[model samples]
Target chain A: GQQVMQIPQYQHVQEGEDFTTYCNSSTTLSNIQWYKQRPGGHPVFLIQLVKSGEVKKQKRLTFQFGEAKKNSSLHITATQTTDVGTYFCAGRFYNFGNEKLTFGTGTRLTIIP
Target chain B: DVKVTQSSRYLVKRTGEKVFLECVQDMDHENMFWYRQDPGLGLRLIYFSYDVKMKEKGDIPEGYSVSREKKERFSLILESASTNQTSMYLCASSFPRTGNQNQPQHFGDGTRLSIL
Candidate 1:
């Protein structure tokens, strides 16, 4: 079975500060996807990383995929109150010709306005 | 835009009662999934269907079952609901493009179920 673990189960930062969350996997993943869930809301798809050592940016957020394909990170620059939410990383594993996903425990972020 | 709709936004059922959560997707997707979201557990897959009449048990499928009679509909059934089963359930669908390694999943608002 594949497992994804995320660090800093909770984080709090002042507005305009920076924040980052890390996701590590016990096994190699074919691809990884990031999701955000606001309080009392459903999870929304954010981004997906597939290539090794790939980096993508969306506005003030940056995502990086490890060269080994076993780790990923999401960094938010100049965080705002609207950025408060739980971030999750899901890894897709191909096992025995079956592709399934394993989600990390998640990192809940809070921004102080 | 992909639209995944869950039958209910909230539900309350007594212990030992049978529960059914329905999900429908307007887009024709080959893969549909059911996941339960808890406080710290994130989202754990309960079941997934790749096609009609085809389903695979996910990480936590005990006490839960799924039905896929049509490509656009998927259902999750709880034979006997328990207090421990109370959680937010989400339904998602994805269409994998040919030769593409990543497929974005569209999720519904989710059904918040509580067992009394």
Candidate 2:
């Protein structure tokens, strides 16, 4: 059984502050995907990391995949009110076809204006 | 943009009642999934369909069944609902086995089911 765990289940920060969330998996993963769910909205795909020790960025957000491919992190710089949401990391194993993703518990981010 | 649509945004059902949750994707994706989200428990996959008329049980599929008669539509069924089944149900779709690049899942708004 594979389990993905996230730390800091909830986070609150000022508008100009920074925030980060960590994700760890019990087993090695082939790839990991990040998603964001705004208040009263569905989970939206953000980015995916495949290669080990890979890092990707989109504007104010940065995502990193651990060298072992069993962990990942998401960092936000100068967080804004628009950044308030729940961030989730989902991992896929080596197997193909019909293999479902294991999702992290998620870190709920709240920004104070 | 990919669009995944769930029939209901909220639903209420009584114990022992049968429930049906409908999900439709406009992208004609080969993979469709049903999941339930609970606080502290994360998102648990209940079932997924990789092709029409084919379904596979996921991590937590005890009281759930799925149907995939059409490529664009997938349905989840609860034979007899219970209070413990109350949670936010989400539907997702993705392309399957395309290449090394993993396709991200597109999710619907989700349906909050309440059993009384």
Candidate 3:
């Protein structure tokens, strides 16, 4: 079974500071998706990356897929209080012709006001 | 705006009791999934149904079952609830745009179940 590891299990940053979370995998992945879950809320889709070395941006947030497709990272510039939540990276892989998505343990981010 | 609805937002049951968690999706999705979320374990899949009357076991499916008699409805059943089963249950639905492409999943608010 493939597993995804997320670094910085918990983090706290002063408001207006930068924040980043890394997702790593031992094996190559077909694609990777990022999700955000607010306190007492369900996980919501943020973005997905497929091609290697791909970089995508959503306003102040940037996402990048590693050149080898074995890792991904999410970076937020000037984090705000509303940016506080748990970020998760899910990787898709195939096993015996069956496709599965392995979700990372997640990185909890806290913004200090 | 896709809406995935779970029957209950919170539930509590005693050990050894049979519990059923219901989920419904307004969007006509081809896939429905059940996952349990723990503090450090992330989201562990329990079961998924791609079509009506079809189900597949996920990473952690022991002591659990699923029913998908209709396309819009998916149910997760606990044969015998235990204290270990106390966690947040999430239901998701996705539409397969193509055969191999995996689309974004729409999740319900989730059910926080506690076993006494």
Candidate 4:
């Protein structure tokens, strides 16, 4: 079974600060994706990284994949109130002739006004 | 735009009762997935279907079965609902990728199911 674990299960930061969450997988992944779920909302697709050591950015958010493809991270610059949500990292792996995707426990981000 | 519509927003059922959750996607995706979300458990995959009438068991498929008679529709069935089955169920659809690529999933609003 594939497992993905995230660090800092809950994070609270002051407005105008930075936030980062790390994700580690038990196995090497073919690709990794990031999703955001707001309060009382479903998870929405954010971004995906495929190549090892790949880094992608969307506006103020930066996503990075580790060189070994077994870990990833999401960094948010100057967090705002709108950034309050649970951020999840999902890793897709190629198992024994099958494709398996595992979702991390996620880091719940809260911003203080 | 892709739309994954779940049949319900909230549902309440008694223990030992059968439960059916319906989901439909308009994107004609090849992959449809059912996941359960808990406070700290994140999204646990219950079942996934890649094509019409083709289904596969996911990580947490026990106590759950899925039907995919059509490519655009996927249904999750609970043989006997229990208190532990109370969670937010999500439906997502995505295009099946070739080789080592992966497609981003589009999720529905999710149905918050409660078993009493």
Q: Which residue segments of model 3 deviate by more than 4 Å? A: A96-99, B97-100
On a 0 to 1 DockQ scale, where is model 3?
0.59
Model 3 vs truth, CA RMSD: 1.3
lDDT of 4 by residue, A32-74 (tens): 8999999988899999899999999999999999999999999
lDDT tens per residue, model 2, B7-98:
99999999999999999999979999999999988788999988999998888999989999999999999999999999999999999844
DockQ order, best first, reads: 4, 2, 1, 3
Write candidate 3's Cα lDDT for A1-113 as tens digits. 76899998999999999999999999988888999999989999999898889999999999999999999999999999999999999888755223357899999999899
Complex DockQ, candidate 1: 0.65
Give candidate 3's whole-model lDDT: 0.92
Candidate 2 lDDT, A25-80, residue by residue in tens: 87788888999999999899999998999999999999999999999999999999
User: Which RMSD values do the candidates have, in order?
Assistant: 1.3, 1.2, 1.3, 1.1
- Model 2 chain B lowest lDDT segment of ten: B95-104
Q: Which regions in candidate 2 have their CA more than 4 angstroms from the true location?
A: A95-98
Give the alpha carbon lDDT tens digit for every residue of B17-107 in model 4: 9999999999999999999999889999999988899888898999999999988899999999999999999999998876677788999
How far does residue A87 in candidate 4 sit from its true spot (Å)?
0.5
Higher-scoring candidate on DockQ, 1 or 3:
1
Residue B7 of model 4, lDDT score = 99
Kindly provide the TM-score of model 4 when superposed on the true structure, using C-alpha atoms: 0.97
Q: What share of the true interface contacts does each candidate keep?
A: 0.59, 0.64, 0.45, 0.68
